[model samples]
Target: MTTGRHAGSRAPGSCAQSAPLVLALLLAGCAVGPDYHTPPLSGTEAPQGWHATLPHHGSRMALAHWWEQFHDPVLTQLVEQADATSPTIAQAVGRVREARASVSTNRAALLPQLKGSGSATRQGGFGGSQFAGGAGGLSAGALNPTLGLGTITTLGAQADASWEIDLFGGKRRSLEGADARLTASEADWHDARVSLAAEVANTYLQQRECEALVDIGAATLSSRQETLQLTERKFRAGFVAPADFAQAQATVGDAVNALEGQRAQCAQGIDKLVALTGLDHDALNGLLSKASAQIPAPPDPGVPDVPAQVLSQRPDVSSAERAVAGASADALASYRSKVRQAVQEVEDALVRLDASERRVDAATMADAQYAKVLEASNARYRLGAGSLLQLEDVRRTALQASQSLAAVKLERAQAWVALYKAVGGGWRDDAPNPHPDHKTTAPTAQGRTHTGSAS
Candidate 1:
């Protein structure tokens, strides 16, 4: 060893130890640039093929084609057409183009721009006096007089350009920000597709459900009308009291009114579906005639996966995650804004989870209460003490409870989708492009309950 300070200089490991420093300096010496350590990401593990709890997203999401999940041909056609021609999707495409243009504009500054410069001029004196200095004339002192328009225009083709050099990394950081924004815009486009698909699917579901309700109402009304006729005949034969006949008529009238209300709701749902597909009512009716347009209870939707992120292909979830990314990129562009908005978006997302939990709880409670009512009514009927009115009241209560439970479940599932999305879950499944190094699944809020109406 040469000395204490130089002792380690020649050591075998010393070179390796200094390699990191050398590399750091090499990176630093080129320019003081913005080193983008990815913003605090929500996910950690690469999303494992649509798990319930995956964190990082993949290159593409299945939910991007959400309508296909319903397996409706008409819906698929409408979605494809809407995707190609809808103003909303067109707007999103325009945004992508604009962001791409911005990136190009910013990147263009990274390289020297060459320009061919040329100028032409016709020099003339005031009042047509003798011209002295023109592009084709001699200098003022070399001319006979200096009173003419002295246009000493140089017509040389000169290429002039400049770049910031990115020495301080400012330009590079700006470029990074721009690049991120460009990608974010692309994500935004994908998000728009997802939103449209979801809107169509959800609305289709609504219309179908409305159709089912109308069917139920029609059946109930027809049944009550028959009962009323039976009661009137029995009263005419003096087999039942007049009060019973009147009651039957009243029940029939109620059923008729209910059916009319349901019909109106079904028509409104038809209008909503039409709006979603941008089709006229006649066109919608034509489409409806070709299909059942009936919505039954949806299947468990295959549960999507345990953590639910396994189905990271859900469009709503993907949209949420894209929003998170957009907010993240936006934050990078404006640091304080990112932090503030990140919290806000996260809060909003968490709230959805909270709302879902609450709805589930409420539905559970409602189911229990209605269960008690149904049990009581059954017991009274068994004892021959409960009137038909009492039995129907309890039956209606139980039915309403079931419907409420279903609605709550649907909303809860939707909230789960919203939470996963807000936290950037779906994107990590099939990212549709390269993603930052992080796993796919992430949660939005604390696992706890909060309240809201499911609808």
Candidate 2:
């Protein structure tokens, strides 16, 4: 009997040990869907080299600090401020947080769940003798503080645990998808920052260009007014015709009109800058006052010889790649289309940037030649060797050339900004791992705060 009793006890222990092993094997079962692999770039997807001209012999530039190349502290500050306060960035951060939470929820589903419960009850009543005796005795017992007979109390507690076996690894696949989405969300956040910084820089550049053009207009107006005064003196002395005097008067009127128009454009540019930087008018004006009105010259952002390297640096491309990885096999084709679009954007920006640089060179040469002609005409006129009409004609040509140069310069700057945005503004896939604590608030421009992921 003793041996049989020991054998029975060991059987229960053996079953208990085997139960955990069985659960672990179930958890390791094959997943239901296909595993993801990155598609290899080939043909049009990857090129040997860029078709567009590479700036600086295809040298690599640190994209993260691309704005610093301008050596403009105000540009850098404005970019930083825009990055901190952009609503688009805030939205991306929210998506990342949601994805992280989903990952946690899915991970927990793979583990055993437990539950505990408890209950208590109490009763009081008269004893058998008191009830059998009569109504009077029962009444007396009810009146008594301690009742006549039985009082009872009961307490109970219980615990339960359950686990839904992942059977075919559905839960694991869900976790995999969640992780991929989290990666995509992070990439999107970086993309937003890159776009916002480029926008702020471009707007600031436009504002400065507007100011420079205003200065040019002022100078041109002053020169035309002096010509008008000279023509008026000549007309009074009967040395010039009424036709000449009328032409001079009209030229001065045109100059005044042009100068006022330039001033209006400069004011409009300021409004755009204010919108982008989230700064009030006074504060924005104060910041603008600190810097001269010259457009900030952007440095060449070197392109990599390998087209694949450049494509990989783009955040939108990275995000698209992650989308492919997260999708079911049936949906992968759609996600790949996004990747192709991203590559196309980079190609387009490269072409524009290369063309803008060449245009700027040509415009610069034209402006210098026009200035020379205007200077010679002024000297001849002052010495009484050239007509006033000839001098005014030269001045008009010079002014047009100057305006063209400024416009081309602005176009070149905008092209650089587009390229910076297309290539992901120097953001890297290997940014430092997100903070472990997951701080939920970040400071914005002007002492304000908003809920967002830490930088």
Candidate 3:
């Protein structure tokens, strides 16, 4: 009897323990899809350090606010204006909002849904009428006994609830994909900002360089006019030939042509700036006038030696990586290719930046040497010891050297901008999440809250 009593008591305990085990098995079965895993980079894919020499020994700068490093308030203001008004940035923001909505929709799908309905109706009859409501009927006679007319009223209400049970983890996987896409959209927004800033800076630099060239052209024209005057005086005294005088006139004509061309180039640059800043020509001119006509020196953007570290900071790369995470097995290969391309871009930018630095140094020395030669030629020509042909040749050489210097400086500045963009303008994976007003925590089937991963 004691054994029987003990066995009976243990039956409920066994069922209680077995019940949880059964529920766990069911839950495990519902988790049908494979969990996402980050792909690891091979040694060849991720280098220990950069192959090209690091600029300024990889000295770091605040890459996120890279424009501020130039110390050009005009540039900063222009970048800010572009950021606010750029259609590209607006599109990106729209995409981020769309992704955020998708996440909310998918998250809501994982929870229960409830619906309620209510209805009321009234009927009149000449003789009598009856209305049904919840197994009871209202008789017309109860409403009006004196007349043969009567009215009946009916009212009904109902409530229903449903839960989808997640049967095969499809909803969860969908939510995961939505979350990744949202992250990618945010990264894309940052990428747009970085690209726009780099473009604006490069255009601004070009405009300044154009103004400098205009100045050079004006000075050259003045010098040629002086040479023409000198040649004319000598020709009248019969000390120089008519051919020399004609050649001097042709030189002045060429200078005038070149100066006009330079002015046109400067004007075109201003037009581009106006378009980029969304400002009218006059307003843009007013802003540009505040700053001197000189190329803003690009500050060294500290690049990390580790390829993976640098890639992580790039918004495009981050977006690509998220794509890989969210992509199906069939689409994974293509997304991985984008990541490889991003790495190649960084390496290419580094090589160009290194080469441009060397070019600038060489060009500077050549410009200085040519200037001295031109100065000596001018002095000799003024003293009537050098031929006009010799003086003109020296002048041309000096001008070419100066132009080369300017071109090389522009190349170096462009390289800096490219490198800045390559490294992601200092954007980080941990940047603040977009649409903070939206809830990140989703309710689970068991009434527990699951917080989404940070962007």
lDDT by residue (tens digit), candidate 2, 40-60: 766566667777777888898
Clash number for each model? 39, 0, 0
- Indicate whether candidate 1 or candidate 3 has the larger TM-score: 3
Best by lDDT: 3
Q: Write the per-residue lDDT of candidate 1 for residues 26-117, one digit (tens) a residue.
A: 76576643343434433322222232322222222343344454466776676665555567867866775676566567667778767656
List the RMSD of every prediction in angstroms.
Answer: 12.5, 7.5, 5.4
Best by TM-score: 3
Lowest summed-lDDT stretch of 10 residues in model 3? 441-450
Poorly placed runs, candidate 1 (over 4 Å):
1-30, 40-64, 122-164, 296-455
> What order do you get sorting by TM-score, best first?
3, 2, 1
Off by over 4 Å in 2: 1-29, 118-156, 329-331, 427-455
Between prediction 1 and prediction 2, which has the larger lDDT?
A: 2
* Each model's lDDT: 0.52, 0.73, 0.77
Residues 1-455, model 3: lDDT tens digits: 99999999999999998997789678868675667766777666666778888877777646666777778898888888887788887788788889889989999999999998876677777754554455433333345667877777776777899987776777888888888777777777788888888999899988888877887788888988989999899999998999999999999999999989988999999888888889889888888888756777776666777787776776766676667666666446655675677678888888988898899899999999999998898889889999899999999988888888888788888888888887777333343444667654211111112235322
Candidate 1: lDDT over CA atoms?
0.52
How many pairs in model 3 have backbone atoms within 3 A of each other, for residues 3 or more apart or on separate chains, i.e. clashes? 0
